[model samples]
Target: MPVQRRIFGRPIPAMSPRRMAVLLGTIAIFAVLTLVFTLPSSIPAGPSLGKFTDHKISLPKLKHIPSPSILNPFRQAAHAPPVQKNSTNGESSWYSNWNWLSPFSSSVTLDENRSLLPPLPDRPPIYTYYDHTIEKEQELKDAENAVLLTWRKAWWAQGFKPIILSPAEAMNNPLYTELQMKQLEAPMMTEMSKWLAWENMGTGMLCHYLTLPMGSNEDPLLTFLRHGEYPMLTRFDNLGSGLFAGSKADITAAVKKALANPELKAAKDFISAVPPETFEIDPKHDALAYYNDETVADKYPKIAGDIVGNGAKGLLVLNQLMISHLHGTWQNIFNRGIAVVKPHPDHMSYAVHPARRLAEFLAQCPESPMPSSCPPNRPKCKPCVASTPLKISTPPAYRNTSDLYTIGTVPHPYTMAVLTAFRDDISIPWIRRESPRDPWVTALTKELLGTGVSGAPRVIKFKEAVASQYGTAHSLWITAEGDMPDDLDWHFGFAIPRNATDNGRSETPVPGPERRPPVEHDFKDGPVPTEAELEKEKALLKRAKEFGEARTADEEKIRGAIEAWNLADTEAWKFARAFLARSSVERKKWEEEEKKYAGGAGAERGKSEGWGRWFDD
Candidate 1:
């Protein structure tokens, strides 16, 4: 009989189920390389496995060996493994697009390539972390698989690899909230302690995450951790050896430098370690306490010193102004009263929140929540009360008496300098004849805060305008909360113009803590105005000064009484008139295009020429 044809092409197939299954299994085994288990070191002496080309492997020359037992899979215990940097191709290459934007630019060197940042180094892995976004899913998945595969590959060994780190924010992450992080950190620290007991990694070595200490540029802790790596490991560990870069290095160096100064870290290591100081999170008590205790040290007394000392002087002028604005000064009695306002940038929760919250309270309110303060009559107010919004009053009123005009290009020296330069064209010289009945100026007495769209430029137009009845250099005051980079230019393009009078008019120009934008008198530059052009500034000062001081003192007393009564009344307006002498003008001008465009973008991203013009009225 002819062999029965099965289906396709007349082939008679009569086989046992086992044989058929074996044939299909062999095909699958050769076709895909997705098996988690190890491939034998060698294959049978024949052609080669499916898709095995010369570029991939020379299987014919390879030795054959039995793979790991399937039943015994996952039975091996492995050390924590390092990550590897491997290129993906083959099928993946089909989906890959050739996109290359080197963040390091072409000028990168081997040192730059090697100098890496420590990625979110919380002690415990962020698997248990909240705030996971879709952007992180791929990275998290890839990292997990890579970690697992590395351990699987080595049977029971560990591994690690190098990678560049980006800014924590753009890096697509929210650090673990302190409470939740402590949950994981406690366990990690405990496990580490036990691991040390079992493996005896010495006390010289540490396993904490890369966290800097509070209120300090020097991180003795980090320096100690990095330096200890050499002594602990018999084999090399890149993770332990070079875990910090940039500012971290600066901090470590500063720690060593400060230690060498015969004060901190001088007598003993253990003793020099940060001590537990009892302190409140309240800004007033904290500022006072911190300043006092901090002053005990001569060299590195306290970070608070920056606030109370230089900051304190500014605070004095500001306090007087607030006092005058609240009660004593009659400037705003008919509804045009002035007050001081501050714009604060928020801070990280775990590490810096308490400091910020405290600082804000101290700044806007008196040192005591009670109305009784320095000047007897100044009214006290709640930190967040709505008494009035005055000019931004964290001060040496913004002035640019600097020589910022040599032809050159360098990063501006901080936000202060930038705003100082921008000051020339940005402020309102004086308001035109608005009524005392105008709601904002008269009734509400509110000052406008700089409100630029997030990621957009700061641009706005003033309605009716007036020339400064005060002076030509229209500088003002401000207060910023976050970091003010050293490169920020507090006195850039807007050099305070020379007076038409004698140069002895050496007044302190506009000043604010590094990055905060200062208040502006908001006017223009012509040949410097002459003394003949001056308004009655002397009479204005004499009349305004004593009244300002007395009113400030009285307002201080009233503030104390108000605080004692648990009222929200504030002294913002009383002092505002005494300090601020700006007259915003109505004008058609395009000034500070960069500021208009600078929504916190870095160097290249900042605005172009700062001058543009609108139609003149």
Candidate 2:
């Protein structure tokens, strides 16, 4: 009998080591066979299997593989479809079959042939009008060129095709002629003619008036297209004419509707009712005056009420009526959705700065020949002698000369400094100094600042020199205190506040008004100044300070006069600051919303809280 051994509490027969090894080997072989039968026999052939069986292996097919209770107790045993290689793309079809493992399986689909994304739609044409009639003035032509070229380049960069409709293009339409005729009766019809041109030229287009400069970032037109489908879209909540988009048919219908509206007749009647002398003398100023008169509101209640509702009393009654009618027409035509969006604070601003206007004049008339109206002995005339002043006219006599030194017989250092500063200090939108070494800048400087004694004589000579050399309808002579001649076109002085410091002396010049930060003001319209602009403004103020010092030292009687003179421009500067501040706030809000939307929070909150709804009325 085998020797018995006590193991734990049980008695077992003790065997030799060879017998124990044989027993363990048999159990291992049995387990291998069990695992082979349990696994699915559909596994693809691979290098691992080749190592074991020389690239060939055969296993008996099992009727069923039991689901392991520990791994997946609730899973039922089933045969999975065999994976196949996609012959076209040479990729395995495992992802399509085992989609449950993929996170994006629901949102995206993979196929052998093509992507499922729809192709992007073509962008609508952008239509902007340039009335060549104004090109009669070389300055106007240069200014227009600068603005249009900038506008075209910006739109082109954003994948838009900008079409600058000329007066000739507008003339192609029969309706444009009729609109032009109506302009004789109503001057505001000029804008209507431009709209007609846009409608006639394209099936669908965006109309952005040239005066409103485009921003470098964010394509507002593209954004409008993505979220809006109305027949018409306006830039402001009040249907401002500055920027808008529509289908040709919709624009035509809207224009007709506006023309036919009874309120148009009322608007015309209100304008006709104003005293002819006042209205004809200064239509813009006097028309606004008449509209603002409390008695006039009572007389033209319907039109006046509409203007009031528009929220800007500064506009001409006819212009306001046009906006009101267009808005009403859009609502009538497309009953669903708002036709107007709140204006972007950073874009679509009117280019109304005096600096911009001055630049335009300088650009056009960099070097003008001595006016024919100047006395033949003018160049040799005594500095203090008063004679009939030269009659400087629009489109100043231009001479084709590149020689900067030949601009004037004598050098005027003070004038050269001022003009150089002016040319270098251009910070307006859509305007650029083509060259730092522009010969015209030097020429204009010499022409404006005459070679003479300093003080009252210098002022008289300076005024005469400007009158003779650079007189245009838009020409302005900025001065301190003195009664300007009736013939000379002039304004008060630089739009600098009295309390403002001479930024030239300070290392860190303040960019806002003394009493308040620019951001605190409630401006209705203005572009947010870029960092480059602020820097340019600082440089300008510094130059201005230097100018004031020179002038003060040369003319003792007018000491501290520059500050008092600058006070005249305070209101305009205040408006500018307010606009800058308002634009900054709007831009900040816009950027914050953009960040929130891009970060996926927009989806969780829904469209109501997104920037899209910000445009909604």
Candidate 3:
């Protein structure tokens, strides 16, 4: 009989030893199978188990580890341990051994030499300001765009960030607004406001967009960053306000100092106190005269010295001339290399004053010698016969003197000086026939003359020729009783010069007895003139006298306009000369430095393109 155990008070029955042993064996096998299947599920899913696969550990071996026993076989699967949670608490537990299964696991070995991914360097900002208020014309807008474009490209190419702000952006600051409010009252304030606006904006670098040329390979901003100790870094040592670079703190401090200057304040006060009507006559007249006054300079020696020493006056002149719209004035300034056109040569001399040199030349050569040959005195011959009668016409009168004043004005003492110098020392001499025969005038006359017939046909031909030579026909066309000829071929019997061939002979051949061959005549001192020829010569001389008188009148008008313009800039011109004289040593040193760096890393890379030619021209 088998004894069985009973719950509560029930009788117990006992079974055979063989049956009990078999039952225990079956229970052990069930537990073993459960462990075998459930062990894998305990390990994390979706992890590379290849590293652990080659090891001696096996599933059967893992079954030896302790696990919760299955009290009911049916519920054993449901009660399996939860899958190992990721180490979200940022810590490892006893189960950390299994962390190798995760790619993000800290336990996994990684390449130690791999970079941590460094951040990019900060690029220095270059600030350029434009005043759109005044630049209304398309030509002005185009010019401004061209200049700004160059600045943008150059700065970008050199690893800098250029920020172009307009008057609107500048006016956002209260300080800029305050300065601008006074510009109408005091025109000089217009320029001063620009400086204030630049300072108000956070600092890194500053320059006029119109004035900055293309940069060289050597990074000037980088150099300043690395070695600069001063609060401000000017292009020349305290020479000009055109360029500056520094930290915000330093720039702010320096600008504040300049703004708070006592002399500057006094000058401003003096100018502002003047009656409003004074400016109405000539807006810049009072201001110009005040700055240029010897007594005022004596009273404000410090400011005067500072202005001259720092080259502010000189730079002011350049800025004024740039916006002046004066014909050839801008071109002359550029050609003279007054601004940063290109580096000056080592041998270049600045000792002699340009004005003085020109004056000396004028004194030595008062007038050009007249040509040796003259028209002979002969009896009047038959008047030159024109195939068709041509009409006489009056040319349009020159622009009024008042109209000239509206072209431009120079308010700065230094600007006035430069313009006066340009007009007297350069412009006047350049055009005056008595001074020298300008190659341009010579070439023009050679091209237009000697092709037309005598009398009115010749006169009409001259007008036509001038119209063709210049840009506008309206300006050159004679204001005649009848309509001016629009036909391109109206020049009666006049031949246009043909292009030269490879051998330097005219492409157009002369119509003559070619088979017989043309004879080259040497008439240098040959036969007496025929009566008809003398008549033609007399007619030509009379026509020439009329042309000369017209030309002289035109020249006089041009001279008067130029003189007015020069007078407007006289004070500025004088100051600039004095400034130059005072800063000769510094100027020499600057030029030497320029020469040293001209072709080195500091030299401009490509030739400045675009409207830079407006300056370079």
Candidate 4:
């Protein structure tokens, strides 16, 4: 017989009767109730019973995003790299696996500040593009300035000034005893010396800064920075910082000379319009762009692909590359783009991808001319709304994609309901503590998992979010929102060390390396819940229950029959949204019944006042 092969320590195609049981139990729970009075599908129609409260609310409009260009298919010349080469098997491959200490790939959503879009559901997507050359140019210019400012903030955020002065402080502080000062000065001065040395060398500076990736000589982050054509610095300000502050007089003199040229006036107008905040690198996902007359400038990819579409894979790949290059390590989808200077547990962490300059020209705009990034002229400011409608589609919840980050198809209602409960009710330790169970989550979980909803995955690896090959959380199926996360099973960050036969050290990824021996954090010892536990959680069904409080035997028989039928018709009723809509037949029937009640002098109030309570129970 063939040897039992293990992939990622877990068997492929997965294992168990465990899954079968989970599946069955989930199904039995989520199906809708049987019809108490003739299939109960009819709904109230016509004039609605809309609740009207003067409660002030702010249903913010969806954020507007420039519609990507779908007109031009991603044009690749015959000589371009083959597009089919993109693979979803992340870290498993040699390329991504080699860089262990590096940050996660793009496609993982990480948002630091507010999101680009107002979020899904309440707000529709924003995908309109304006043809305004000057406007986009101005937006880029503003973004570049913002980048510089954010870097300046970093200096303060990191408390660089104190850290920078530490060496000098050790030697100069008189309060220190002479011997103590000497010792203090030695180590502090040594660290400072090392920092300066690494700074000069650039790549080696990473080693002096942080532990693991940054400090490790083996790390690839420094490789990324040095690999660029211009040798991009750890901080962009390093570029302008080199220009002496004392040289401002000379710079001003040169500026006046260039200003004399008539051509410079238009350039000045564009530069004057760039808002500084646009360039503020969030270390998460934020693309600030402005399209100049000649070219478009934005940190984000300019390619337009369809939802789970055309060039999305490529764009996501590029995003991953950039993240790996910038932050040393990051956790995405946990809450968009969360960057971890060190190791972290959750996959979905908040992160931000600061706007990258699309081009040099757009980076110089000044902010005075209504630099809202909106166009001044009518032709360019076309909104996707009334003009060309926006089309939005989520990843498939049911059908699996060839790639890792995308979910297969829309999940079943019970799946949605289960996830909804998990998202809202169960608070993972980091984000929340002692969050109560949400009613929606309670209902959904009971219907799907505890109840045995169909199409539901019996076993879910609740937390696992690293697979450099695919995108991160936000970029994947489960967004910061409580939707389904795309590839729970596929992300393979944990590299288990197997028998010597598995692979040699050479095969191990350079960044993460092979994990230490083996430790499953085994939960296998957990005993099943005792009978007492089951009794506490179990609900009671009262034999005295009846529909519409009818205590008569006829009413009891009809109600019992309805309940029994519902158990058998689980699938059809689970997705029966039609029942939620209003029906004219039901309305007329109710109206007739009301007229009869009025003619019969209110028919002496029913004997059962709170009769339907048990059913709710």
Stronger candidate by TM-score (3 vs 4): 3
**What lDDT score belongs to each candidate, Candidate 1 first?**
0.22, 0.33, 0.31, 0.23
TM-score of 2: 0.28
Candidate 3, residues 509-606: lDDT per residue as tens digits? 33223322222111122233444543443344333233324547655564444333333122122222222222233223332453342122112234
Q: Give the C-alpha lDDT of model 1.
A: 0.22
Give the lDDT of residue 429 in candidate 4.
Answer: 42
- Which candidate leads the pack in lDDT? 2
Sort all candidates by TM-score, best to worst: 2, 3, 4, 1
Residue 362 lDDT, candidate 1, scale 0-100: 21
Each model's Cα RMSD: 32.5, 29.9, 37.6, 34.4
**How much is the lDDT of residue 170 in candidate 2?**
57
Candidate 1 global Cα RMSD: 32.5
Candidate 4, 1-617: lDDT as tens digits? 75677778986664579998998877766453334443545756655535544456888754552223323467332331222222112111111122222222111112111111101111111111111122334344333322222222222111111011112322343322332322333333343232222222222112211011111111243223223222222222212111111122332232233333344323322122233331222231111111221111222224222111323343233323222222211111121211111001111111000100000101122121122222211123322111211111221111122212222111222222223233322112411333222222223224235534432221111111212222222222221112121111112111111112111222232222233332112111122334443233221101111122345775545434432322212211211111111111222233345333212221112223221211111
lDDT score for residue 450 of model 2: 40
Native-referenced Cα lDDT, model 2: 0.33
lDDT (10s digit) by residue, model 2, range 186-247: 43454555656766775544444322222211234344543435454333322123345556
TM-score of each prediction: 0.16, 0.28, 0.25, 0.19
Pitting candidate 2 against candidate 3, the one with the higher lDDT is: 2
State the local distance difference test value for candidate 3.
0.31
After the best TM-score superposition of candidate 1, give how far the Cα of residue 478 lies from its true spot, in angstroms: 5.5
